[model samples]
Target chain A: MVNLTLIIALPLLMAFTMPIFKMLNSKLPKFIALLTTAFNLIVLSSNFTEIMAAPLILELGGWQAPFAINLYVGPLALVAAFLINGSAFILSIYNLSQDYQFDDKFYLLFLMITAGASGMVMTGDLFNLFVFIEITSIAAYSLTTFAGGSSYEASFKYLIIGGVGSVFLLLGIGFTYSAVGSLNLAEIAASAGLINPLLLQITALLFLIGIGIEAELFPLNFWVPDIYTEAPTAVSGIMSGAVSAAGIYALARIFFTLFPAQQFFNYLLVIGVITLIMGELIAYQQENIKRMLAYSSLAQMGLIVTVISLGTEAAVKAGLFQLINHSILKVLLFISAGVLISAAGSKKIKDLAGLGTKKPTAAFGFTIAAMGILGVPFLNGFISKFMIISSSLNADQFLITFLILAAALIEIAYYLKVVQKLYFEDLEIEVKNTAVITVPVILLTLLIIGLGVYPQLIAEPLEKAAAEILNNSRYIMTVLGGI
Target chain B: MLNFLEEWSFFGGSILLIFIGLYGVLSRKNMIKILISLGLMDTGVNLLLVALGYVEAANAPIINSVNPSNAAAFVDPIPQALVLTSIVIGTAVLALGLALVMKIYDKYSTLNISEIRGLKW
Candidate 1:
């Protein structure tokens, strides 16, 4: 019996004791981060089969579900945890090669963010979710300032927005507690039908405004591009790939389980579509490569949210698949682009011209990931894209389908522009010795192609997770009934 | 009237504090003031949470020699626990924000947030 609590606890324990490790050996924190994430992945996989068979609910302090905090590792949560830990693991590998000024603090924050994100996914309590969200956000705010210049401003912007959003989230929690007299997610879901309509509406809106900021929904995502652009590459990779996945999981849990209402789904649909179009359009105009990728990441987030908001099992599965693909592909893109940026000593897309020959591995990484995102055949993204299209069509949402396709076209144009600059254009700047990130690149690439070729590899878990997310009664019964 | 004061006053005052903090957050130009406003907002939310768990004529949720067995007379303790956690989280965030604001001050040599447009939002 692998205790799932270790997934969060080990990282947090390591993170706080990181300075002690640093005191003992100057070279210990990065490897510690890597080992922690690797162990987390191992722990998650060890419990995978059992959790797939039945969701594991761990009651803290020997108290029952309604009265105590619990960790619910449903199929959906298990998949999300895998994605979160998987990203942290890959980024830890990337971090091993790079050094920061206060690297011990960096690794500390890094581990905490991973722990916080995993906690967000597995937690069965709403207040616990808020705590995890705050943990992730605080770590992120500190992590962004590592770049040391404009990064402070970026971090400040993110801090202000995140602070306000958290306040709203607390208000929502208060409303939920006042109404339901409980904070357990399953308990709330079971009696959620009894919440007064007006208070429900207000609480839902407060939650939307709160979680939407973290989930990168439209209008609430203004702080995203700057933070992604200014933060170190590994930080950007984890934030885009891991933390946002947790955000979406929280959103899905709230809207689907705690308050499954047609009205909220409609609100999400509109917000997701708007976020998608806005992200793509803004990405089209970015001059900086990281900022471009940031906007593209935002668009991908919007795309995932839209697909899942369709409320069909197939659509949810497709959304989750796209989410998995986006995490893998974006991490690859950011790492490769980070290399390219350092090699060129500039962030402009034009300056990166003709690096294809100078930096073959990184160029190849960027190209393959870009192509994967653009939905080229035989890549993981292609299957998810196909699923999204077909699922939306099945839902008979023609206008949404058109908007999504249009966003894809915009995505293809910008990504191809960067790729063309990499290979086809003349060399505009001399290259420097870039970090050797070949290992992570190669690993992510293989996974992308492997999943692309064998789409059925994750078919069962994705289907089960989709069904688990859609059925609130199953969640309520599993958590409360198990008591 | 006393019942109204007990119920509406706590709720209304905290909500008003939240709005006032929000207004300060939006209307203030200085970065420190903005952070202070954020603190106010956090306090307001904390207050509101405590108020939500408030029960009329109830005591603090403590077990003493005299009130050892009476659980129903006690106000809810969950929100108070939540408020404590929230306060800690809020303090950490505020401190981090203030540290960043100091760094921004060092770089831009000004306290005005509008002037620190190194990266345009």
Candidate 2:
């Protein structure tokens, strides 16, 4: 069996040794980072069968559960770790083609962020989760300022908001520990029934607010657009793909395993609806391409949150499916947008006119991504949207079903506007297409279409992931067996 | 009043500190002051975590030759460990925030956050 600890250790070891590689050659760090992520991807894939068979619990320092920190690698965590490592590998390849200052620091921060995200998903302790969150945010904050213009301002704003969010998260962990007298998530959940109802409510709300900031839920997500727009496009892609997915995983794990309150689900549903409407409506007005894509990403996340909030088996399954689709689509959209923006020398939608003719492949990739996000038929998004809508109806949530469909219409409208602009507008400037950028975009586009045509390929795994998420008793038993 | 103070002081005081820090973050325009407030809030959280693990009249969580076996007399070590990690993280964030503030000052020539609106909705 592959040592699951190496999944996090390898990237971190590479990140700390980045300075040595930098001293050897200015161009060596990126390759080393790429190799590390590729290695991590290989290790993770080789352990897929083991993860699917049973949750792998690694007890650090040779201590048993409830006494020492542990890593609970379940199917849900494996799915997220795979996404993080896979996206990092692809993004590293994309990074190799770009020329930027501070190359060494960039790769170092990138690897650290990837490692931190993996730690966040796999950690079995609440305090460990907070530590991993801080690691991810700190690395992300540094990466945001890599461009050294408005990026500094964006990173500062992110630091402030993220700092506040971490405080809340710490407070929630403190409260949970005080109540349950254990820091282990499984132990806390096992003893959750004994906690005071009012205290549980307070802790739940604290966690919701804390993790919601990272998850890009409605009120706390104002930092999304500015950070996404101002940060380097590769950073923006990772932020949208791996970082946001980790945030969603954290939220789902905490809510489902620790505090499965019906009232909280109602709160999640209402907030998700509002976020969906707000994100789409706001995205329609954005003149900048990255900001538009960022808002659209937020709206998709809101839709997923709504599905998961339904708390049904089918709903959670559909939510995970959408999560995977959104990760792939955002990566394609953002990286392609990076290519297009560099080609046009401006991010304004008007400035990008006629690039469809200049770079047809990238333009087509963008169009397909836009269509997939809008849930057009024969797309991966459509399958997930169909599942969520039908599940809502099955749950007899008529008003929610109506609201969701309404949000879908608004989503389609904005995406159509972008697609029309991409293909139908008059050519204003010529664009230079490069192979490095075009290849990843096309590869992700193919993955989207492939999944769309054959949804059954991921159906069984996603079903098991959803089951792993919903079965709190199994999680508890797996982690704290007969303790 | 004494009983109330004794019972609620640590938790209440930490909550008050957190609010004060939040108010500073929202109300203060100076970038350095905002970061200072963030540090204050982190300190408050650390104190709260340590307080949560307090046992009445318990000793520090050290096992010595004299008192090696009585676990109940020692304060919980987990929260202390958590606080230690949190404090290190807090320091790193504070340092990073300060570095960003320095850069923002260098670019804008002012520490007022209201003036740093280079990118907006």
Candidate 3:
């Protein structure tokens, strides 16, 4: 009977109190962030079995569901929270080796972003979701500026886009509240059938646009390359690995649970496909390693969105699996890429040529992550990619299947280009003293290989999560029955 | 007709404000103006949220002796509460955006976003 709220509260409490800790000792914030993320993981794991058995609904302020803001941690949310906190935990370790100007503020924002995302995944109220989204976006907006050169420009662009997106989100929430007379998601889902059809469509469209921006879908993701390219490596890693996961979770919850309309799913399907193809095509052209990885991550988000939008249990399961894989692989890629970029003294792929011998740990980390993403066998990405294809084929989506494979081909082309350069090409520049990230790289590699070898290790959780997402009525019933 | 005007005016005005802000964001090159427009959009959304809870001839949500026992007479309070929270968040974002704009100005020596071509697709 561990209180689940502490997963969010502890990080936020620690984040806000970070400056005080810094005043006490300048070195305390990083350890505080590390401790908070670790504690969050422990809290989440303690509640995992119970939540999987039955979605844990915690009503706040002694009020019942439909009357108060509650937190519903179903298997889907639990898995997403795990990914968010797990990425944060790993990145906090990554942070220990790196120093930044105003390191205290950095960890503070980092911890807040982690807390905000965890809140986004766990909350059962729409307004609470909006608040969490704002918190995460604000922290992200500040976090991006840490790189200090063109990062200001990137942060501004992201701010404008994110600001507009939040307006739409608020409008959507307003519409939903006006129609349903309740902000609690479970209550709204229970009564959503009664909303006027046209209004429902409008609300759904508003939410799609709003959440779509955060999820980095097609036509609304121009800010992705810049922010990911300009932000510091750990910031970029968390943005890709944790924040975007939460964004997709919110989108899925909105579309699948709140408004299960086929038309919306069709829209998501089309958007996802376009995002996938466009991202890979653009990623293929980037000489900057971080920007290429950024586009590739964008494409992965699109792939996950398309699969989940298929609105089948198997499709959702495959999507979630791919999501898990993407988070793990992308964090490793960013971390190693961070190391490689520093060692090569440039962001250009050419400058990083033949550093494999000098920076073997980083190069190996990057190569394995890339190979995993390219769907080489006996890697985590291979399992997810196989599952995605099989599920899409079972659903008889030939065009989608074809497009996905085509994207994978482009992915392989660019990734192999990097790998070939890493091991085969001559060194173009003298290597700098790069931080040794042996521990995080080894840990992530083990997870990737271990998952690939025995996919069943996470099969139960993935299946249950997919089931939880697909069955929104059960969500409504569970939350409402808690009253 | 008056009732319709009252209702549609709030929705129409807010939507119009949002469109104006969006146009400013897309059309203006000056960064400060764009942030102002963003503020306007946020204000518009907040207004719309508050309007959503409006009830004709309704009292405030407070339970004073004058209007006590008329629970239904008060406008829906949730949207107002939400708007309060949103207003605070909007201000924070605006403040953050302004700070970023200041830093950008310091770096590029210009406020025009088009001139600051450090990043492009």
Candidate 4:
């Protein structure tokens, strides 16, 4: 089998290749991108078990161990890769033949964004992670602004705040490197307990702040609603679904691997609770459909963070299961929201009145998504939430269980607002939009429904993933060799 | 004496500069000025990287005639290498941010963030 390094590097290769292919004709770019991503998705999925079980490390250029920049794939990496590549494939198909033209350059940047994201999920080195993050950041910045006008304004705001975050991240990387004398994540984890406490403390705080913005955590997440509402829907899908997961994964990885700390979890718990309360409360106030989903996404991530910080088998697995479900449900919600908005000719929630009558199938997909998010029975969100509540309850966290169930109600309220507008409100203008469910969006909707019905399809793999994360020494031993 | 004082002054000045950047981002009206202050904060980070890696009476990391084992006395090269990458990435971000500021300016006509509070909650 080809090394897993190819999984992270293919998009970079295609980024360069797309420009060259443009010399022949612009038509070649989209297929080439599809081919590269398809190949990556297949490769990543096929090796899913090997990476999950064995602490697989793929060294770049045949260099060995901590000396080489390595791609370390454990269960977390595999699950992230699965979500990223799988969703990218679906989103690409959905975006194709939409109003926007997929020029050679656009496809090239798109593939590069995918590659950079996958690389972040796979790599085990701090320096390389920074490089890949920049690749993704630049691609995201330019991609969002491709619509021009206010998109540029929103993108600028993202860039300024994002730049500040980047500086903090780089500063953290420098401090950590100076302390550990190596860039390898496994090595850092091995040496973490012994590093200078002051330096490690500084580095950890810096990274927490830096990556928090990208993850859309509170106190630094002021940019999300604006950026989400402003970006094109496909970009919005990628931002909320794939990129947010990447940022959270980075935060989780560094906290778990680079610097394991009880204090960090304490911080995560407090911040996550605040974000959950604020996000749902704010989502309740939004008029725009996309903006509301953005707030909902923030709240869901807040819940994930809360459970992830618990650092238990059940809690971690519940978090992962929810993460997977959230991504699937979100894309379904976002794409259908886009379709509904397009049909109704305005993005304002009130303007979409009677859209249910106009596009019944799309309306039905959105309804299922709403139900899934609300943790209704038999759906995937319910299983994950049940796991979270059961695990928390078992752990004697009665307060957590109470808040989680309360948050579920808030989720229901906000989602029902949109549902009511679509089904109950009057449609002054009959949207002539046909019930044309595009192939990729349809597939994505089905995946959401399917996963909700049978969460074991994802939870089993996530459990394996969660087990790997807790077994930190396996990662430490694999890359640094019994240190 | 004055030259030595000037040299040592950069130490406190760098810290002050970072504080200033923070203050600007926290309190400024003009978005562009806030972005400039962000660049200054990056300067502080880069400076910190450089200062930590500096060795008092040392040569550069490159060596040919010198004994290899004695290289410990030289400035730590890794942080410098790391910071060089940071500086380039910072420049790229600055350029991108400036482009965005120009766009924001073109649309809103006013650079004051308070004036462009149209998207706020």
Candidate 5:
């Protein structure tokens, strides 16, 4: 019985209030942000079942379905909400301990990023998705450089790259609208084929490049490492975990709802495989911890793409599960890396040698996250990786499964290399200070392990979500207003 | 002039602009130049969006027409709305890019991306 509108509106309203909190006090904004995200997470998770059962649809401004902005809520969108707010909550806790300036504007931008992403996941219109993408990009560009000097530089590069991506997306959305004469996604999905095929094909390509930028696919991923490395670790946590997940979520929504074409799905398959091979191959060469994680993020996205391209109910299910797990675990890994970098006095993996013995708990969190990502048994990463592989196999996409597994091996290769460096080797230099292991750090560590062990915690809802996404008939009926 | 801009080639040509911009980004070394190249690509894409809704001889969409059915023949205004939003976003990103370039210049004193390898493995 939770009101879905309130959940969606909470973040948007916070965007406005975030700025004013700065006038009151510097820390007020972040404190407000943490409180808001925590509240939204509780509200969304508590009503998770009610919304999933009925899948509440709200039309903005009382405009009728096809013509107005619509908010569509289902288990799929709710899962995205949970992952975003949950990680955002943890990252805010980490931020509370750091002494950074511009706290007000930073948190304001952060709230907008969260709101924009949430809007993308919940919106039912093609045009609205583009609008959300714009807001998300602006917020992301600001936050990417919010760490200051070099951060500004990285944000600049990211802005250019992101700008290109947005244009591609806008062109795609425009073309889709022109062809079908409708901005509603479900309507576009139903009627896209009736439009000129060539135009639709081109639009699909545009959309791919557009979304691909945020998704951190190959070639377009140049901005990712720089942004991740230079930006404040708190913001990077959201970027890798929440902001970035929004990209994959939007990609899934558009592909399923606006242009569910066989030919394009096949293209997705090839492109995804390429990203998988390239992302992993390059990640192995990285020496810097943040850049290494950046490459790993690409590799993870490639796996999500691969699973999604399989385009079966099982494949979609596995992909969704992996997507959530990747977001959560990646955040944990990035934050742990941030803590290590700050404590260890060096960014290079070789510099981090032997420190784990000195700081067991922080390193332990890193160990759990790294092992989970490598699909080591009993870790959350292992469960999702197993599901994606099995789902692809069940769909009889053997070659893709082989490639994904090969990528996983590379994943293990790099993850273990870091693990070895953390445990076995000692830094040639004298040991320094370490980031304090606080309650939030302990909580994140425990959650990663808990979810890793009981993956059914996520899998059950993902099953419902997968079924709902593949339920094209029901989706079309809702948007098209009955047969 | 309006009729000329309304041709199907406009869309095709815009695609070429995107490819050219991509080439610039991939091949260019100067950070500022690469940014310009990105701008070129964005322009091309935005033009394509505007071109998508071009119906020759149509006017700006409004309900001023005496008859209801006649309004269907007017230019599609949806693309115009989309373009406005896209243009605004593009501007924000470009400003952000320039600001970053200024900051990077202050730190590194050079615009050459190749020399900017402080974070490299």
Candidate 6:
């Protein structure tokens, strides 16, 4: 059995040692960071069968159960960790081709984000989860400003918003500890029924709003666009792909395991629908490509949240599938946007006209991603979207079904507009070479199509992940070991 | 009334500080003041966490042979550990925020958030 702790620890070790490597060789840090993430990806993938068989519980310091911090390696957590490390690895490869003045610091923060994200999904202790969240946010905040200029403003906005979110999370944690006299998620969950109903509700709300900020839910995601637009493109890719996936995982973990209530799922349904509509509508009006993509990503997150809120086994399975699809699609979109923006030297839709013909590889990759996100047939996104809609219908949620379709129509409208501009619009300016980023873009595109063609490749794992999420008793048992 | 105030004072004060911080973040125009307010909120949260673990005349949770039988007499130590970590993280965030504000001032030549409109809806 692979030590589950290494998944979180390896990246942290690599991140902290990056400075020393930088001192040895100026170009060494990026290479080390890349190798570290690649190693972690391999390690994570190798343990798939083991994790799928049974959840691996790693208690820290050799202590037992609620007395010690533990890392829970269930299928749900494994899927999230895979997404985080997988995207980080790809982004690291993309980073290798780019030139930055502070490459060392960039890699340091990058690796820290990966480690923190991995830790966030795996840790079973509430305070430990908070610590990991802080680690991730701190790294993210610094990374937002890595490009300087307007990024400082973007980072500051993220700080203010994320800082406030952390406060809410801490307050919620305090309240939970006070009520349950325990910090372990399983123990708290087991004893949750004994807590005051009103206090429980308040704590649930506090956690929802707190984690909602990171998950990019509507009303809490105002900082998303600015950060995505202003931060470096690679940072945007990781933020949207890896960080947001972890956020959603954290949200799902909390709701499903800690506070599984019918009313809360109803609230999630309402919030998800609103977020979907709001993100899609606003995404339609965005002139800048990054902002458009950011808003669209938000809309996709809304869809996942909505489906997960359904609380049906098939719905949760579909939601996890969509979450995976969104992460892959966002990585492709943001990285392609990064390449396109760099090629055109502008982020405006009109400014990037006809680069599709100029840079056929990137344009092709972006088209595949756009189609996948638009739920085009023979793409991964189509399958997940179909599953979610069908499951909603099966559950007799006709209103939700209609709203989701309406939101998809809005999604189609905006993404199609960008597609038209990419291929049909006349060239207004010369485009730069996109040779460096084309590899990852093409790889992700192929993955999208391959998955779409045969989603059975991931169906078993996603089903297990969904079951892991819905099986609250199993989770409690894994952590508390029959109390 | 006195008993209620004494019992709930710490919790109430933390909530009050959090609200004040939120107000400052929303109402204050200056960037530095906003950061300071964020610091206030962090401090308040830390205080509340420590207060939650407080027991009426409890000793510090250092258990040695002399105090082996007095484990129950000591206060809960988990919240204190959490607060320690939280305080460090809060400081890091505060420093990062202040650094960003410094850079914002350099780029825009203004501290007013409303004026730093490089990005918007």
Per-candidate TM-score, first chain only? 0.99, 0.98, 0.99, 0.96, 0.95, 0.98
Candidate 4 similarity to native, TM-score = 0.94
Q: What is the lDDT of residue A444 in candidate 2?
A: 86
Q: What is the lDDT of residue A395 in candidate 6?
A: 90
RMSD of each candidate relative to the true structure? 1.1, 1.7, 1.2, 2.6, 3.1, 1.6
lDDT of prediction 4:
0.80
Q: Write the per-residue lDDT of candidate 4 for residues A324-385, one digit (tens) a residue.
A: 88888888788789789878878899998888877887787788888888888877778888
lDDT of 5: 0.79
Candidate 6 has a DockQ of 0.75
What lDDT would candidate 2 get against the real structure? 0.88
- Spell out the clash pairs found in candidate 6: none
| CAPRI grade, predicted model 4 | medium
Model 3: residues with Cα > 4 Å off, grouped in runs = B119-121
Candidate scoring better on lDDT of 2 and 4:
2
Q: Extract clashing residue pairs from model 5.
A: A380-A452
Clash count for candidate 6 is 0
Model 2 chain A: lowest-lDDT 10 consecutive positions: A427-436
Q: Please give the ranking of all candidate structures by TM-score, highest first, separated by commas.
A: 1, 3, 6, 2, 4, 5
lDDT for each residue of candidate 4 in B1-121, tens digit (9 for 90 to 100): 8756654665567667777887787678787788889888888878877766776768788765773666457888877887888888888988888887777788888887787854332
Candidate ordering by lDDT (highest first): 1, 3, 6, 2, 4, 5
Interface RMSD of each: 1.3, 1.4, 1.2, 1.8, 2.3, 1.4
**Residues A1-483, candidate 2, lDDT per residue (tens digit)?**
679899889888888888899999999998998899989888888888888888889998889976779999898898888888878887888999987698888999999999999999999999889888888989999999887779898888888999999999999999998888998999999999899999999999999888998899989998998889999988999999999999999999999998887998899998888888899889989999999989988988898899899999999999999999988889888888888888888899888778787878778878898889888888898898899999999999999899889888987887787678777887657665454576687678778889899999888778889999999999999998887
The TM-score values for the models, in the order shown, are 0.99, 0.97, 0.98, 0.94, 0.91, 0.97
Docking class of 1: high
**Winner by DockQ between candidate 6 and candidate 1:** 1
Per-residue alpha-carbon lDDT of model 3 for B32-98, expressed as tens digits?
9999999999999999989989999898998878876865588888888898999999999999999
Q: Which pairs clash inside model 2?
A: none
TM-score of chain B in each prediction:
0.93, 0.89, 0.92, 0.78, 0.82, 0.85
Worst 10 residues of 3 chain A by lDDT: A427-436
Superposition error at A451 for model 5 (Å): 2.5
